[model samples]
Target chain A: MRYVLGLDGGGSKLLCVIADETGRMIGSSLAGPTNSSYNTPEEIELSITSVISEILANHNIARQDVSIVYGALPADGQLSISTITKNLHDGVKVNLCGEYVLSLFGAIQEDYGAVVQAGTGSFAHIRTPKTEITVGGWGPILGDEGSGYYIGKNALMACVRMADELGIFTILQERILTYCKQVKMRDLCTLIYATPSNKQSTLIASLCPIVGKAAAEGDKVAIDILEDAAEMLFMQASSVLKLPDVEARFPLTVAGGVWKTNPLLFNCFSTKIKQLFPQIDLRYPLFEPVIGGVLLGLRDLGFPVKAKIEELKHHFSAYSISADLFQ
Target chain B: MRYVLGLDGGGSKLLCVIADETGRMIGSSLAGPTNSSYNTPEEIELSITSVISEILANHNIARQDVSIVYGALPADGQLSISTITKNLHDGVKVNLCGEYVLSLFGAIQEDYGAVVQAGTGSFAHIRTPKTEITVGGWGPILGDEGSGYYIGKNALMACVRMADELGIFTILQERILTYCKQVKMRDLCTLIYATPSNKQSTLIASLCPIVGKAAAEGDKVAIDILEDAAEMLFMQASSVLKLPDVEARFPLTVAGGVWKTNPLLFNCFSTKIKQLFPQIDLRYPLFEPVIGGVLLGLRDLGFPVKAKIEELKHHFSAYSISADLFQ
Candidate 1:
């Protein structure tokens, strides 16, 4: 039977899956980060090859049986397709795209829709029948509005302002200090400034949960920050929808750790978007991006997607249940 | 003749002036930066000694003749008075204070009033006859509202947003790219991400003049940045003024390179403050901050400051004119 491989490479980790032409998952594995912007080409190649090799070896499947490969890598930089594909086994056709593209595909299960991914960083991808557009993926220094990094950085600034007596006191101040193991404001400065630039984003992004927890507990400052973040994210989506020739009533999906973990932020975003664009048809993604990659591989193999969509969905649901029972 | 030395040690440069107790300027010199936060205590000591030695040698003055020394070091961190004093020549009494303190003394030529300094960093110091309060000097990451660093960083963010198509195209975008010698949006990203954190602030602050130039040439994005910056600074001043027991009608002085160089920003700040507090007694400083150091030294020497203020101001003006003519 002909099989395919699917990969989702993000900043922190990589997920891979192998499936039959009918979209039945046969093997899966996880590996380290493969973000091209943060990692060298050799590192990315190693990450991709190691995961694939592990799955193939575990399942006792020969390389020739895997007809095609689909990879959705973190949209950190302009990744070269040849560099990634050249390392794969012979006769395996590779299709490479950004992680956000796979996220959109995973959400709508089609080539058309809008997806706003707000994890450590935030970006929006809008795809139509004729056009595709992206917004707000300029990283922390430039953009990343409404991202976890943005929220966390703002929280730190609020603490400083409070310490300087320019802002009223808030619980966030104590929470942030304790979180950073700092007793004084100057110590916090030392902590932040002393961290390396490459590691600073992750360190700051880690503070998002603190802000979210505070917001959930009704802290005014924290709530304001989340609300502002939601507003900025919604504006990103609104900007895409308002673009000329783009449909206003297409499917909209919110993905990523920030949205999945913080229901208050998600709800705030939903309400703001609805208030602005009443006609938008928001939908929850049917599967993870790795599954979307599987679907892309199936399509490349000339499989009839429309007829198998319902069957594949049912199969994955059952597969998940069986996997959980064994665990 | 017995002379008093006044030293203003900042992040970029050190300014020292020697004048007799009667406030007659005898010698002055400049040296490298000695910001305590960015430099080691040893480095600061070395900078201080270098400038003092240069001025003394140039004017043929002895260390024993400099009986009183007042140095205002930038309030980047907690400066040690003993460490600095121990290195100075014996019999020379030293009084040390924060840069903000001397800025206030220079602007009002007295111990009371408010001074908002907006240089590479921004801070406000308000001194009442009985109490003193400070606001918003938390460095670049936390606060620096209307500072050159603030403006420059905001300008960089604007360029990123514009490049991502999240913001409208502006002339400031091209100006920033050209200033950084970046050819594409990706190049800008690499440039910023590769810069070391310690050097990043200086690099970002260097972009301030480009923003100022763009604003002067009627760029909407640049103008808005300056306006927002001015409003933030005015808010800092307004916050301190509204503090309980703080006098509302004291002389207010705006100091630092940001206010000194950008007339448009200065006007915006002035208009905002006047609109909020019409009773404020705004005044131009009689001399530069190093001269404020001179006045402080004279105060420590039991000199009559009230009688010498006018004479010192006149002497410095004449001194500057003669130096320029001779050069």
Candidate 2:
């Protein structure tokens, strides 16, 4: 029985899975962050190795049986892949690319479609038969509109504005204060500015679920923020659709933590997209990007993918992965 | 002759002016930045000392002849005042406070009125006859709507969105890219994220003039950004006006670099305010905040302000000090 390995390495955590050539998932494991921008290359290599070792040990699979290793890594995580491949069992083929590309393949089961990845940051990617284009991946400073970081930062600004009497009062103001363990709004500056940049991004992104909770409870400020965020995201997709090579009817897939966790945001985003492009089909990815990696690996090896794709979809139906586990 | 000194210390530079008891202009000098948040306490003290020493030396005045020293320091420059006082000649009384407060006194010639300081940062202050209220001085990260920093940040974001084909194309895009010496639009992320935080704020705030130039040339994106900025500022003042203790028809003084330099932004903001509150009388400050510090010093010393106010206004008209000199 030939087997393959797939990994999804992000800024927050890493998910690894091993499956048979028929796409039956045999075992999986999780580990710490492998984003090379945030961690040393050695750290990332260690993390990838530990997760892979755990999977093999648990499933009683020989290292020689694994023929391919594919990873969907954060933009900065490209540095660690060579080290990971060399340390793994000899003769295993390794492929690594941006996490978004893997997510794109996973969502549509092919490279040609639109995918908006909205997690700690956000970016939209569209792959046509001949070419591909990306939008809004400039990180938090320049772009990342409709991202978790964007939403959380706006939520924080709204809270400050409310405290300064420049905005309407909302329960979100009190909730954010409590969430940060801050007694006075003025002290929020210390909380935000005093932290290191990476941790700061994470701290701000962590507020997304809180904002979503407030929106669910009918907080006007929270609703407005989410609505504005949804519009920004829809604009990203609309821009990608305008690319000369992009097909108008291709599936538009939404992925990442923001879409999965915030149903209100997703509903707003989907409704706006539907209103604008009624002909386009929208989809929630059938499986996580790790599973997409498996599909990508099989295709790279010139293996037939139709049967494996269907099998993976069937497997995902029975696999109940907790969202909290990844975060 | 008993002389008083008033200094306006900001992120960009320090302005020191010396005048006699009758508010007659004697001597003035400028020096590099003394903002304690950006510079070390030693650096700030040196900058302030150099400016004061230059004024005394050039004007042939003895240090002991100066009886009062009042400074309007930036939010972060509060540390340099004590060092400044301790280093000054004996028998001189030193007073220091937030730059916004001194701007309020300078613009209104009293301790009370509505004053909005919209330079690199923005904050609104309302001093009613019986009580005082402040709004939106939370700095660039949390609030600073309608500020130079806010306008510049929006312009950078507009450029990124334009590059990504997610926003309307505008002249500001070319101008910002050129201004930053970036050959490619994507390089802006490196330009923005690579700088130290203080220099980053200064660099971003520097884009304000480019945005203003684009707005003057009628770029739609620039116009929209300024219009949005204008609304945010108007809301700050409008909120302060709604305070119960605020007088119905007090002078609303507009001060700071944004209003001083960008006639288009000022026009938009003033027009919006006029449309919303016809009862409020609008005024441009007759003197800079350094002179406001003088007014504050005089007030603290129990000097009658009416004559001195008239005298200072007359002096400022003849002062011929270039705004660029301070910055």
Candidate 3:
């Protein structure tokens, strides 16, 4: 029996796994961000090939034994099979898929459902047997409502606003100042502006957890910011529900760091979604998108995916559980 | 008679003028931004000295004959008299002050009023006979409501949101797409993120005028964004009014490119200000901050200011009437 491989590439990180026909995931690896939309074609190829090499070497599996490869990334035809299969077996089938499917199938067993995936960026993916659609995955400057960078950005802005008396007093100012080890607001602004563009997004998004913690402590300002973020996320979901092809009965679930970091956002999002579409079933994702990638690979390769999914789930209890594994 | 100099250094540009003791502004020049808070001390000194040399050389005046220099800048004690007067007369006097005073006196010709200065960023300054205080002006990342950057940023965000179907359709999507020559939303997001940090803020804020044009065309999204900016600006002013040192009746006027770009923002701001504080009088600024700097120099050095103010206004009618001269 040949082994099938699956790789899930995200906006900020990468994950890969290998499994035989029986559904047991034999190997897994983590790598840097590999989104073709954000990275160069050469960079994307290098990341993909390197991850393949490392996983094969670590698991002591031969590259030629892998009969098929399935990859999910935010790409737009930037990669080709001939390029990815270099130095390996000729004509090894490679399927380059969008990250949305990984998020969609990893969260639910059924084919008809929608998932709001919030990681470094955010988007809602709705899919059915016949069609699929996406909403609100614009990058930092354009949109990414309820995303990590957006939450962190608002927290920093609130600190400066309170200092200027333009906003009411909030614990974010004190928490952010102490976190950055800054005594004044101007320094914090400098830190954000001075950071090189390569690292600026992460620097901003890294503060997301702090905002979540602040909301959990009953800070009104933090709660308001989180609630607004949740409302925006709900708006994205509502936009998906408006699609003529999707009925109101489609199952909906939330995934990503923002939802798990704070219960308040999830509660707000769920409450709003129910208020608008009470018939739509809400499901907590059975698995995050990365694990969903592996399952997609198994089924696409004509393997027994259900038993393997159960076997792989039992084996990768830690790695395949969450969307934000590297964080 | 000795000549006196006034230099107003702003967040994005600098203006310098030379006037005779009798209130005649004989020479004026434009230079690059010289905010000490944002630029290095050496850069600040270079811009300052270069502007001084340009004005003096253009006017055919001897440096030694200029007895006093009145400079209003966004500085945090980054300059010294010895460093500034290195090549000039040994004992020549330099009166360095914060830019807020230039905004305060330029707009009202009186010491007791509040001026909301909107440029690349926005801030509110209130000075009564007894005390002076500032609200907002926390830079782009922190605060800057009603600022050019804020307006432009929101406009860009709206276009993408509309594309995702998360927001209602508006003329902004068409206007922005045509302006950027972009066929897709993803390319637009890349264009913004790929811009270098040095020119990024200016590039984003440049869209402020475009947003105003859209609002004038009756785009509801554009109008909503402008109204939000105006509301934030009103919040800054209200914060100033909350000060215990000043009564609520203080004159409140808006001065900046944003106020003059379109009448919509100013109308909204004025309506809200009056709705909350009817006794507070609203007046148009008599002169922009640069001309205010010249008048300040003339008066502070014990020279005639009022007659010169009228003379300068008549001769440089093109310059001093608005805060956005260099734009």
Candidate 4:
């Protein structure tokens, strides 16, 4: 019974799933960030090796027993990838894929479609039979419009505008002060600017949930912010739909914690996209990205991927209950 | 001579003008940044003392003979002001004014009007007969719409969007690459993010001129960016104008390096503003902020401030020929 391992990661954490050739779940493990772009090579290597080792040990299996290892990470901003498999078992057949491909494979399952991810950062990936392209993943500063960072930063901007008396009054002013545990909102600048540059994106993006809370509470400012963010993200999806090669009814899915955590944002985004492309098949991802990694390995072995995916998800439904997928 | 001194400064530099009680120009000195919020109190004190010392020494005037010392610094982020005059002459009355007041007095000269400063950051100040108010001076993070930093950042955003193939292509993509000495527009992220947070605003705002260049050459993306920035800032000025106490034909002036460096942005903003508030008296600044400090000193010494402002500008025009005012 050959076993395959699937690894999916970002700048913050990694999730791994190990399964048999038949796609029966064998074991799994989690580890720290392994992003090649943001994390040092040393850090990436340590995360990959330790997690693989932990899973092998946990399932009472040897590293050499694995049939294949496949991993996916964010493709944007990557400067170099070097010697990642130096410590892995020989001939284990390790392959690394871009996060967009991982997400696409997980959701569309080799079909021609588009995937939009809106986690801490945001980007859109469109996959045609012959071509694949990503858009708007310019991180926090250059792009990431309608991502967590964008929504969170807009919430802060609204509060200060209210403070400046030029903006309509928003409850976010008091909410932010309460959330930040400060008398004034200006103290937030110190808290945000003092953070290290590498972590500042996450620090700012973390405010998304608070904004989500405000919108849920029916705060107009928060609602406006969420809707504006929805519009921005929709623009990326719209841009993809406008590609000459894409079919009129091409499939598109919105993924990431941002969509799941905020009903208002999700509903707003969905309404806008559906309004523009009425005939398009808009979808929520059917399988998480880690599952996509596993399916890639299954496809390499020439197995009937659709059957194996269903079987693995059926056997692992309770196990996949972790919030790991949403984040 | 019972000389009076006026000092106006920001996070980047300090400009000082020394004059007799009648506002006859004596000597002047330029020094490093003395912003109390971003700079160390020690640095502020050092800058103030050294600049004052330089002017007194240059003109062979005794520090003890100085009658009054008035300075204006940005009021938005100031945590506190320590003793900035400990090194100066004993019994010298050192009064500090908010930058808004300095700009206000410099332009309106104690009249009821509004002053908007659009330097590296953006903010608006209104002076009524009864009270004073500042709007939208929330620094780079919270506000500063249509500021140098805002326009510069928007230009970068447009370039990356074009690279993503989702935005209209603009010459700015090539211009930014050449400006930063990079092969691709993405390299700009590295150049910008690598700078320290304290200086990042200025570095990003520095891109304002390149954006101005593109707009002058008729890049639609660049033109759109400048126009959007103009709209955002116009909202701030419009908000101030809407106040119940402000007159139908209130006096207003636009001040800052941004206004002088970019003629296209100026015209776009001016046209939009004039179209909306046709009755408004929109004037360019009559005197620079440091001279505003001089006017403040003149007003304190029972001098006719309008005459003194005119006299000082006439006599100092040869020296103000320095791009120091534009910057």
Highest-scoring model, DockQ: 2
How well is each residue in A1-327 modelled by candidate 1, as lDDT tens digits? 898887888878888888887777787888778876678877776777688778989998877788887788864333435543554565778778877767776656778888988888998888887788888887787778899889888898888878877777778989988989999887888777678666788888888989888888989998899999998899789878876766557789876767654667877888877787888887766667777788888888888766776777775562221212111
Taking the tens digit of each residue's C-alpha lDDT, what string does model 4 give over A1-327? Answer: 687878888888988888888767787899888765577776777777688778988888866678776778643223212333444565777777777776777775765788888988998888887677778888776789999889878888888777766678888778777777778766776676666767877876777888888888988898999899888888888887777788777888877778766778768778987787887888667677787788788788777877655665686564432334323
Per-residue accuracy of model 3 over A189-223 as CA lDDT, tens digit each: 88777776667777888888888899989898899
Model 3 scores a C-alpha lDDT of 0.76
Local distance difference test values of all predictions, in order? 0.77, 0.78, 0.76, 0.76
Model 2 scores a TM of 0.88
Cα displacement (angstroms), candidate 4, residue A224, comes to 3.8
Highest lDDT, which number? 2
Candidate 2, A1-327: lDDT as tens digits: 778888888777888888787667787888888765678777787787788888889999988888888887763444555655565666888788767777877666767789988888898888777777888888776778899999998998988888877678878778888999998878877778777766888898888999988988999999999999998889899988777765557788877778766778888888988898887778767667787788777776676776555666666544332433222
**TM-score computed on alpha carbons, candidate 3:** 0.88
Which DockQ values do the candidates obtain, in the order shown? 0.48, 0.61, 0.60, 0.50
lDDT of 4 by residue, B84-194 (tens): 345456577777777777777666565578887788998888888877777787667667899998988888898888887778889988988888788986677777766
Q: Candidate 3 at A136: error in angstroms? A: 1.4
C-alpha-based local distance difference test score of model 1: 0.77
